[model samples]
Target chain A: MNEADILAVIRDELARLAPEIAFETLDPALDLREQVDLDSMDFLNLLTALHQRLGVDIPDADAAKLASLASLVAYLARKGAAPPP
Target chain B: MPSLGADMEAGALVEWLVKPGQAVKRGDIVAVVETQKGAIEIEIFEAGTVERLLAEPGATVPVGAPLAMIRTEGEPAQAQAIPPPVDRPPPAAPTLAPAAPPSVTHPSPAGRVRISPAARRLAAERGLDLAALTGTGPGGAIQLADLPAAPPAAPAAAPFDFSQMRAAIAAAMSRSKHEIPHYYLSDTVEITAARDWLAAANAERPPETRLLMGALFVKATALAARAYPEFNGFFENGAFRPSAAVHVGMAIALRGGGLAAPAIHDTADLSLETLMAQMRDLVGRVRAGRFRSSEIADPTLTVSSLGDRGVEALFGVIYPPQVAIVGFGKVVERPWVVDGAIGPRPVVGLTLAADHRVSDGHRGALFLAEVGRRLQTPESL
Candidate 1:
């Protein structure tokens, strides 16, 4: 799968995970937590889902890379679709 | 793998604690695994049936390696791909404690008596003894307020944005301060006896295991709480629910982040040495960021001490649910006359913030006075 496809999948997955939050109305520029009240657990769940779906090794330290969709998408592009084995 | 410790690598199928085809609830420990860290029990997060045990006990494989497949109550599990096996003996379980499941045991969230490292360093640089100031952090771990008086340095040219963590803290604290009905109480204590006994106690123990002032205070607090159960319980759902356990919350200030109060469960049950060891382990793990999620959750009551800081007195904000939060100020040389002669003696200031809706100031004062009386006869410890 291409990077864009993977990014779309991640964004869709996050939206599905948190139906209570207005994920569709989220501005690409705002902080994720401020926009959706995503606590630390929610952040971990997002990373866990991405890890399972994409086989990506999202280290706990690199959790900061998920601050915004653009950063997240950019990170996936840099890391690529098939995660490091 | 880039790490040496328990990263997702090199797992061993220690044992199948549950039988195949058995129904298991979410968070049920299905199997045990011996990893480099120790024997960690694998828990299922979703309710399901143990459809199959793919790997036998004593088999070794890299992590993300499946050992068993569980079929959800109604749904079938997808086919799991088996990766190549690594030629290694079943890893031996280390002597260390097993990896506690995050769901089962969250990190203890008793706020440390707020004393920050920067504050400690600043106080030290200014030749200030920290034991004089009252902490304002959770459980009263020393924060910047506990720092000795020093000239303010020039502000940095570029201001830094509040980190997400800090922003969350600001919101939570603001909510706590605004929403919680708070009441304050203060008292003074003579610690002359405790000080002398403490010095002797330190002389006996190894440097690594020396008792800190916080440890002494914790023991004393536990003793006093036994006398005054009302101070230890919380006012919840239009009633006061007293905790059966004397879990003392010691507020600790994280190095560069917000404060957390990790509770010492059943403080009255633990010996001084055991308490100190637990505190040491807690401090080390907290600094290393290895705290389990649950450890940072619910705590009954909190204590905030800045006795190490040079400040004379301060009030602490009451963490919700808990009716009272105790603040400890520095022990200072006070001029008091004894036997018709004026002399300098070490004294402490304590401030207790209670929810007045449940506890009146008079009741709070009585509790503070009881704590003060305990400190005078430190030999009881």
Candidate 2:
């Protein structure tokens, strides 16, 4: 429901997609695809996983904006994807 | 054990999902085998009861070696005695077991040379010359080694060693290039229609069920392959054998390193949604190292897309036995002339690397054109 919670969900889903990636070493400002080597299908999977876990709708057009971890967390927060407190 | 791929020589049995006396129908996942690629769930293709587990877990059984014995429907319980372990030798070396009885070779009343059931099956599968082999067993029965030397046993649970996978791929690709006369062809198809159709379709659906553009390419390729048999079959025994069904192999790159192109069976008949779901499941399982044996072995043709990797196009080497591979590059907006007017249109580069022995450039061009035409009308796909 909080920023940290949203970030944790993103990290978990990304980890599921690319288990080899170490979240602790990744720079949140860098492009996630380049950092983790995610193909389009894996990216779509991440979006789907995030949507399922956070109840957020990630439109195709907005996918480009959520390229980095920081942006993804921010986008989810902006979309009010917080669970009821 | 089934040949998981052209490169797989031996597979280590990881675990048995079925027990002796368990009833397994066709298409059931009965066991898991570890290969250079990863762990592949072995499927049983016949309705039968598991009579016995032949190979022990963690043992690297050579390809064509029996993993389990199954009693098919209507077979008497004592119909056939268990065939001796024909192909399996100690991983270190092929040793003749002194304790085991020598091969029993006896001529039948009709003058047919006697052979062990297991040896006969392996010989038939590999097209071995039975007459050439002097059976070393009790009665000069032709054995598995008489056919051809199986590749050295691979270590168990290699765990995605990139170097090993690279070597296997190199051998297969080298063999493919050496054996098959491959011709390369490329075409740029405008997919504005498909993009629009997919976007609109996905807008109405939830994220979980949304369709990806890759599925459309796969479906279009499958339909085109169904129409063009030359591009949809195996080249074996010095001849081209066209498959009746189109099982499109989708190339998925693993995060760890290397890649796998597992088949999505009967792709032409699946709805777009079904194909998308199957593709998702296949990619997930493939990455997790738990794909089915049929998925690895049954691809009649393969489709490789570098679109996600940002490559404009690629000419892929033909995976042996399968005569052709279709490649798609990243979809990008490029200037195009439609009705004598030049404008920006979204297009993707499509390439086909086909065996010249099976088809000529004329037919290959037609297949690519058909694929393009199908993409123009995405609803039909």
Candidate 3:
């Protein structure tokens, strides 16, 4: 699995958690804070799910990079763990 | 999701505590969910019509999971026909046919209200009462600044009153005083040199970024801990857990005699100016009761200052597991023989109370000496 697969899973899990909005088609360039109405608890839940499913440790120091979808994909790519094309 | 009480993890859905189509008030526990933690009440704040039920008796979900669709009261539920998620109870068919033109405009009832999402979020985080706000925005929507600056706390109804907050504090203090063996040491420091350095340093910085006396105290405490690392940790579960980094909690007294101590994370890494700015900000938030739970806990060491109250000497009761607390007394002018001549000099007292089980008299004395030295020459930080 790679960045795209991971991103897809994230979108699905987020949508499942809070179905009030249509966030599936949101652009990677859009800020997560702006695109989806996520509070601190939601952010924590998102990270917990990612860690459980992807075997990644999003340390508090690096957590800021997960603020947007594009940044997350780019970070995963730099780590040589991008989602499969 | 199961609502959590004081001790519960998972809860059984007992029943719908509120009736369908009935208006529910904010914080109204509309449902009761029983668990090992006990019967817990589920609550919400939005004023809305219960369009559908998402969970039934005997079923359970984690806390914070969406459990129902609450459409604004008086708004046509089907006018916004977003499909309800699975496991949610389905609503009856729209009273008006789907083909009927939408009759209501459904304009946000608060006319022309246009608060920024960010402002609204901040208000929520701080639990500010939006209804009390006189908004400054074009639509009379509350701006961030327009939100009440402090947490809403009403006066206790009766004399000799103790709130739940006071009860919790009493329990915590009782536990700390009973469990922690406290040994104390106090010293006086002549800060003539340190004051000069601090004044010079402030002169070099921007007005908004000057280091205040509180920052100097925090920096000195962090430095003193380096000389006495054992004091820089928490004692928990019958053992001492040493912290990799020292986070100093600064105690702030709340308006009504209750107290809060919000930790200044990594105070040592921050420059004096930054520490000053952050300290001021955190202190304000503490008084406002705006700090998150994370901010309130996990301090490696703690400090309390009664200097402003003109206290000549004071010692704090140990906040347990955190091995030590340092207190500062007010600086006062006294005639002292410095370099052989008598002259009035500003002098302050330092007090340290350490866990006797973990810290000896010698170590406590050493920590106090170092703190006095640093207070005398705080520019070293």
Candidate 4:
């Protein structure tokens, strides 16, 4: 999928985890855990959701690198998580 | 209404999942009640048919008040009269008197009146007759206080709002600190083995079925509790009653503000895969504001974790009735001595806050050590 599409998918999953988080006010560079106050379980669920939706496997070792919104979208793009054409 | 937690004095009935005349077996979710901890699905322990609904959907009822009447097996089908809702006073200090006045008359005394010295002095000073007063103390003993006329019972109702939840938490924690003589001990245990084992296990499993370090900590704690019964029970009425089963309460922080530690029943018997699934389901249901009454009520001991994003360690306050609480902190790399060689290893901070009345520091130390030892071999858990 495109960068914007991947970003949208991430936002949707994040919203499901924390409905109170406002995506418009969320800074893409900020740590998602601090921004949304999500614990480890919530983060794991987010990754699982993204993996199911984008068909990209995010191993636990790479979890630290995708802590921010911008990094997560970029990583999904790098992983070639393209929708079936 | 059932006592969802120690601090839950009252709850508002949100909805009834079962209707009158509906047949229900034991462990059926009967209704939903909104407490300070959010909506809890009330479960019925009796196998019976619903005779009548006592409380309305929006009525705020005190704990132990009748919500419904059930006709058990082999009972006549005769219609039973619905009892009126119990008028309970608002939650207050234990020193406060009950709203209902004690009956003035008593049965003929077989022996001398059992009155406290202080009460005797107070009665003589006040020119009051001790024979006319009823003693509410232990074994009909009169205490040193004048019995005032019973006041009007006030409804212990509060809005089912978030701030009220904060108030409930404040009440519970305050009660815990005031009542429980807490002794805290901290130990940093190496979890490299557990981490490695989890990684290898998860590498072959699907993401949905993969295990987390939390499940291991819970299992270890449960097993250690089984070995050391002192740390797994409730201290009530000046006695410690040990539980036969280890139902570990996992503290879940709510998104809005407060937290709830609901029990994962029979944690010691659950496999790692099953424990992880149950943990995930519990967290999801807690966030969704739906959990069973027994989950909220039947925790023999509590296990709290700050998660990987939190501080190095936390010493939790023992939730009252329960004698102990075990806390797990974020796992971080720290220099350690392994085979007399210093190297970096993944270790997590473990803390135990136990009631001094139930167990001393020596036994508490052994319990913590046992937990650490169990964590060292996660495969057994």
Query: RMSD of each candidate?
Result: 22.7, 14.1, 22.4, 17.9
Tens digit per residue, CA lDDT, model 1, B62-133? 554666767776676663322122222222222333332112212122233234443443454455556678
- Position B357, candidate 3: lDDT: 72
lDDT by residue for model 2 over B210-321, one digit each (tens)? 8988999999999999889999988776788899989999998876578889999999999999999999888876775557778888899999987556788999999878
Clashing pairs in 3: A2-A82, A2-A83, A2-A84, A3-A82, A3-A83, B1-B62, B8-B37, B53-B89
- Cand. 1 TM to true fold: 0.49
Candidate 4, residue B104: CA error in Å? 40
Q: Give the Å error, residue A37, model 4.
A: 2.2
By summed lDDT, the worst window of 10 consecutive residues in model 1 chain A runs over A36-45
Deviation in Å, model 3, residue B24 alpha carbon: 31
Task: Please report, as a residue range, the 10-residue window in candidate 2 chain B with the lowest summed lDDT.
Answer: B93-102
In candidate 3, what are the lDDT values of residues B1-381, reduced to their tens digit? 532211122335655645566665554445544333123335554666666777776666544455666776677754221121211222122222222111111112233344543355455555555566787864475765686533322222221122533544554556667778898898888878776776667554433444556678789888889778988987766677777788898876654356666578887788886787777667545443344322444577999876333477788877655789999886677888989999998777889988987889898998888888877767677
Better of 1 and 4 by DockQ: 4
- Fnat by candidate, in order: 0.00, 0.29, 0.00, 0.20
Q: After superposition, how far is residue B141 of candidate 1 from its true place, in Å?
A: 33
- For candidate 3, the lDDT comes to 0.60
TM-score of each: 0.49, 0.81, 0.52, 0.81
Worst 10 residues of 3 chain B by lDDT: B98-107
* Reference A-B contact fraction recovered by candidate 3: 0.00
Q: Of the candidates numbered 1 and 4, which has the greater TM-score value?
A: 4
Per-candidate local distance difference test: 0.58, 0.77, 0.60, 0.77
